[model samples]
Target: MASSSYFEDSSNELTCAICLQLFEEPVTLCCGHSFCSSCLENYWESREESTACLCPNCREVFPQKPKLQKNVILARLVEQMKLREGEGSHSVGGQAEGKDGEGDVTVNRMVNVGGHESHCEVCNEEAAMRCVPYETVCCERHMKPPKHKGHNLVEPEMKVEDPGCTEHGNSIHFYCKDDESLVSLLCKAEHQDHEVVPVEVAVAEFKGILAAKYPPLVESIKQVGSQIQQVHQEVRDTQVSGREKEERLEGERREMYRAVDEKVNHMKRWLSERQSVKLSHLEHQRANLQQEMDSLCEEESTLKASLKELEAVSFLEGYKDLLCRLESRSHFSTTEPAPPRLLDFPVEEQNVDSLIQINDNLLKEIQNGRTPSLDPNSAHRRIKISRDLRMATRTETDNPYPDHPDRFDRYPQVLSSESFSSGRHYWEVDVRSRGRWLIGICLNSMGRKGRGKECMLGGNPESWCLQKCENKYYTVHNNRGTLLSVPGDPERFGFLLDCEEGELTCLEDSRVLHVFRGNFMDPVKPAIGVYGDDGDSVRFCHLFMISFIPFCS
Candidate 1:
């Protein structure tokens, strides 16, 4: 209260008579009365071309346009008074009545301020307080004017502007439910048909509803969190159980390997012992047969000796000796036990050996394989077919062959003259260089003239190929390639086509590379392509039918 009184007393001292507000850049005249520097300057400038300056407040004239030395002490006092007035406004209040005098309410409401002080819109001086209803700041003197009458003089620090109605320029007191907005008193009158309530009543009802629902929302959040924790625990439990199962599986796998090894060893030992016994029995039989043969030879020699003697006395003597000897031999043979019967192994064992022999024959057949010659009519221009038509090589220059409908136009590829519609055919190719190459088969009706996918080997449904490009191996069919895990790069490749079985297999150095299975409804010709200009060449080695004899030695 005392602070307010003190500011009121000092307000007159701080005010500039010309501006009727706090001094801004106050300057003193020779008369010792001060006024705003701009006001004094303007007063002098408005004079009739005078070489003198007059103090607007004191009405005193100067000999010349007095150098307006700023009144530093008066400026300081004005600033101090403005700050005090701002502080006093915060603690003051006024009672005002709403329409129909429903009740008296304090007009002043405290609010926060911005960092810098606001200037009065009327006097252009440091503002003492903000008029909330007017949406402007005013000096202490302007606060008393009828223009700002009944308005709340809040602290100059107040940063938020009152939510006033834009069109009516009135304080919003009621909320229009239809518009869902706070409206001024005049706006409420305009919305008289709309459902409206005081802002305070709306706030109270909303708070009650929010307070009731907030607890359930919080409870639902807790329940969800608990379920999430339970899910995480279950996941951890499953991981532990899986680990345990894997460990047990590993242990069982080891045990199975051990048991297999032991069983194999036992079988090996049993077979070895059985083989030895059979061999021993066969050896004994061989010895007995030899003895029998020797005995026969001796008997024939004795008979010849007897015939040579032929004399009465000699014949009789030899005959008795021969008869005695023969009788002795016969007696010895009869006394000896009979040889054991020769027996073969079980049929299962025989089948195992037979399978091995069949595989061996198949390998031998592959070694003596046959090959097809490259067809000149189907060869690309960039591919030079050998004179014998057995090899196709990529060249920088095109071949001098006449254009044919069956020839390839874009890629350096060639098809074999011979095409197979049925029966299994196996062929080999020599791709001995470190160059890009393809070895596969294609339908005889496949496209041969375009530079598109239909003309490219392995790019159409009519073709399937195993290709080596950039030192990697792939089996491509219908434009899709599958990478192959080859043991090593092989110079020679073998392709076996079983039309009856609908299977085509590719092998390198006797190792199976890949196999493709599909319907061979039409005849397919052997295809070979060398990519690049001069680094690649492929030779058609030979083709032969693979004779598969099952379970035969």
Candidate 2:
């Protein structure tokens, strides 16, 4: 007889340390200790912030969190131990009454062991084993016969579940391929004309399908996993690049401010110097005028005193002195001081042009190839704006949008949020090839409420567009349509609206498709039009990739 301690030790081996229960989906850690996958994962999740991942049993630390590997041998052993325990319990419960009148009962475990309602089919006794070939249950007495000796036998509890139809209560033998369901012979009549086959054949067919599809599915998962990692790395790199660029731009802005301040200070100093020099010159001129006036006053007083003298000698001397002095004074010249000219800063014209050029360059760098978002307020009733505000589609049903003056009511059209009044601006649009559509720039004051030529794009003077009607492309402006002969159906096209040049050019694959030359009077915004709900949609490509001259000029 096996000792109780032996069974207890076997049970302990199959038990998990964390749950104190039999191991379910047992996995082995790096320290060679086994645990239930869920229990270990839960324990690790509770201490997720901890730097070191330590094994529960051995307290061994791993450099990184280790992946759990399933222990197949340990799992099989656990199943065997559970089956043995179940058989032992059944044996203990099976007790037969003794032959004596004392009403005593004795248990014969190996012979009469049974569980639930399982019983021998032939002897009508408690069944202990199942015959695999005959698919019947039998007791130990029947199992020992010569006819059953060569038959494959297993514990009664290990018998396969009945494959019977619940509705008809008949054994299932056929499978309906169309419905992918099991059916009995009687149930087969209900699934007439369906591809019915034997259950065994259906199982093999499904197994074959799984074998064909499994490898590709696994490969796809691996590719997606690799893409996820690549995306993660790209995100990190982009974040770092953005931060660096922002810092550089901030420093440049500060430097520009500093240069402006220094120029202002220098101009102020130059004005102060000019004012001081002008004042000093005016003061010197006033001092000379004052001295001359004082001298003339003294001479006049002497001449009057001479005239009052009666003596001939005094008169003659005074006359001669007066005449000489008057002659000398006549020879000296006194002119009126010239008027002071207004002080002006000597700003060079060429320097002003240079500063303007610098400003233009900076603006080009900032606004060149800028991606504009669609203005939801300007979307038509049938247009649906995406959450990103970059895509707009025409739908069958009207959107429940609130009343706004900017909303397009007459046509399925939408405008961009940004309006360009001047400078060369560029943007790209991706066109779907199914239905009619138009992409262009339009005046902000264009009509929006009526289904007239004024409200339609390229039908009035307020809009210029590249229209796609079926496979043909046309440039329309000012109620005029010019068919453009393009090589192929280009799905992606760009619009270059150079307000300064008074031109709007459409480009396909870097080749100019058409150009509309007209003076734009007002600020123009990017516009898109969807004719109907034929899956015809246009998306604004949010890309800032631009080269030098075309976008800047």
Q: In model 2, how large is the Cα lDDT of residue 512?
A: 72
Residue pairs clashing in model 2 are none
- 197-220: candidate 1 lDDT, tens digit per residue: 556545655666798999999999
lDDT of each: 0.71, 0.73
Task: Give the per-residue Cα lDDT of candidate 2 at 175.
Answer: 82
lDDT of 2 by residue, 217-263 (tens): 99999999999999999999999988977776676566656656766
What C-alpha lDDT does candidate 2 achieve relative to the native structure?
Answer: 0.73
Error of 1 at 552 (Å): 14
Q: Candidate 2 — worst ten consecutive residues by lDDT sum?
A: 544-553
In candidate 1, the residue pairs with backbone N, CA or C atoms under 3 Å apart (3 or more residues apart, or in different chains) clash, namely 113-157, 370-542, 370-543, 371-542, 371-543
Q: Against the correct fold, how does model 1 do in TM-score?
A: 0.36
Stretches off by above 4 angstroms in model 2 are: 1-369, 547-553
